[model samples]
Target: MLRAIAVAVLAIGIILVALVEAPIPAVALTAVTGVTILLLLWPRSSRDSVAPSAPEPPMADARAPIEAISDPLLIVAGSRVEQANAAARKLFGAHVVGEDVRVAIRHPAATDRLAARQATADQEPIELAGIGGRDNRWQMHVADLAGDRALVHLVDRSEGHAAERMRVDFVANASHELRTPLAAILGYVETLDDDAAAEAGTRKRFLRIIRDEAWRMQRLVEDLMSLSRIEAEKFRAPETAVDLAGLAKEVHATIRDAADPRSCDVAIAIDEGLPLVAGDRAQLSQLLHNLVGNAMKYGRPGTPVTIRASRGPGAMVRLSVEDQGDGIAPEHLPRLTERFYRVAPSRSRSLGGTGLGLAIVKHIVERHRGRLDIRSTPGEGTIVNALLPIAPLSSNRNATVTGPA
Candidate 1:
């Protein structure tokens, strides 16, 4: 009857811990349950032979319950560490068991909070920067316990901090991008409004500039929308099979039909009998167009912009786009996929590039569970390869297949 009660109480303690932030009560309950089990399971003959003088210390009994927690937890009695869980030991060190809590943590904000003498009803969490490493962020929550003891819970906030930084940076960059073109269009329109600057030649030049800026804005908005859409469906890998050979030819023909001067220089080389890859058809089409369009914009006039598709190793299909132009510097290659990161901002703008082509391509590749590799030499030119897995036999059966041209 007592063992059953101990088990039920232990179960209740664990469930309560999950539902509340105050682990001290649960920890005490857990310690009591642990000691109860030990006393209940003692040899019946040994207990009958002699009466015990002192009960065993509960500190040893508390280790099992605390060790089950995943996050770093420390029980600080006064200024010194009473006990630490496995996670805390792993973080601060095995030697931190008896060390001062302030010395173990070693953060100004955390130290200040720990050293405070006045007792408060509620202790607010303190943010500790550079706790374990330079980029690490930790939230320190302290709960007052009996006998001046405190429960210190350290939650890693590094990933959340980084994601927030990225969101802020993205918004800033996007605003700047849109603002620049809009300013230009507004400036040109305001100048054209003046009779003095409204001569036939001047008016025509101003209107042309305005039209180009409008187109640039349009492209940026479209690319931004496309990126959002791709990110929204990133976890849902497309099960439909797409024909690489036909898609390559279609993208090439579309480019050929465009009015861009470098369109004629774009070439397509697709391997015969290439198996289909599982991917979204519309996204795949956009991916092809972005790759081919970027090559056309950056490659030198009258130079070849080759798009090749072939069966790759590991049952994957390799689609590569090569451009004959002054290649990107080695240092810039790694960050090329970051949005609004341009090697030559002025040059990119003049070429009508929205600075999102590679970023879009990257998200598209990620959504398809594919790999993107960009290889370049300063003078030799650049080539980008995307490796997409071939559709499985079962997926192929249900895939929407396109006929070859």
Candidate 2:
């Protein structure tokens, strides 16, 4: 196009020169027109031949349909930032473009791997700080793009890591708890078998020890089964309306009769007009039985274990088992609900505790959407409070309560 325009201007200049009668003026005008034509037709390279070539637009600009991704994408040229997608822009900010890859990402591990020229596939899991948020983990991959350009793709792995860690911890703890009972049972049985032909009294004592160990193992297995069942049925609430006061009375009566008649004293305080609770009748009975039985076994021989029940606020009933016995310290209180966690392991084992009683209690209370509180001081006593929501009374009968036993 420039060549055509220059030819037209030259032809006009020649025609104007021919029409003029003056030689010098026409000759000067012709020279000037010719120079203008030359200037217009000259190639750009002749003027600034040393100037550098302008860089090509990024390859990501004309990317394939597969490359037009919704996931975040980053284009890197060596250690420099070349381009970033909209998702990457939102994640790292718009200012990240044209900045050094290391400075833009602000993660030491990522920068170090890029600097070392190690392929990302061989690099350890690199923790990226301030990329998405503090807790987010990103696994990076480096792939070769056109020419020297490289693509860095990140995958979020925070949730996967957390789940794996939880699985590992659960397995370790469960195995440890189970091993304790198995080891004891195994050791006792081995000893009994080896010394069975000895003295009659010694053999009898060894046999008794073996029996106790077997019972302990049995209790642990049973508690595990019970926990599994409770977890499975936790979503469904009990269909029956349980009389909280009467249940408390039944538990108290059973415990009182079983108590040493001459030593331990049992007292019951079921306030009059206590409302019935919404709970499983059998589970509630077992809950009360466990709490009271724990108190009796651990309470001092002459001290009294008091069972109290009263109507609580918000259509709820509160039952408390208070025992005058050696209490738990503050540090041990938090872990009392963990399976196989005991304040005094030796004492708990001697008392034939499966170490799952408190854990079971916690699960049951949670299933009922109720609250359980344990309060204790080192030398005073411990109180276990179980609160359950009350069922509305039927129109025909008022809520009833049994008197103290």
Q: Specify the highest-TM-score model's number.
A: 1
| C-alpha-based local distance difference test score of model 1 | 0.79
RMSD (Cα, Å) of candidate 2? 22.3
lDDT of 1 by residue, 1-405 (tens): 665666677566566667655455346456434433533443332445567654333355546756655568787778999889888999899999999888898887887887773456676788988977898888877766544666777877787888788899999999999999899999988887766646799889988999999999999999999999998877667878788789888888989899987888988898899999988888888888888887777787888999999998888899999998889899999999999999999999998899899999999998787899999988778999998878874254324322211
lDDT of 2 by residue, 1-405 (tens): 665665565555555545644333344344334433433333332334434465544444223211233345567777788777666777789887788998888888877767764444454545554467866777765555444565666655666666667567656766776787678778877877887678888778766877777787777778778888886767665546788888888877776677456224778898998877778787887777778777877887788889899976676789888998899889988888877787888888788887778888887876666789999987888999988877663221212212111
RMSD in order of candidates = 7.3, 22.3
Location of the lowest summed lDDT over 10 successive residues in candidate 2: 396-405
Q: Candidate 2 regions off by >4 Å?
A: 1-174, 259-264, 393-405
What lDDT does each candidate get? 0.79, 0.68
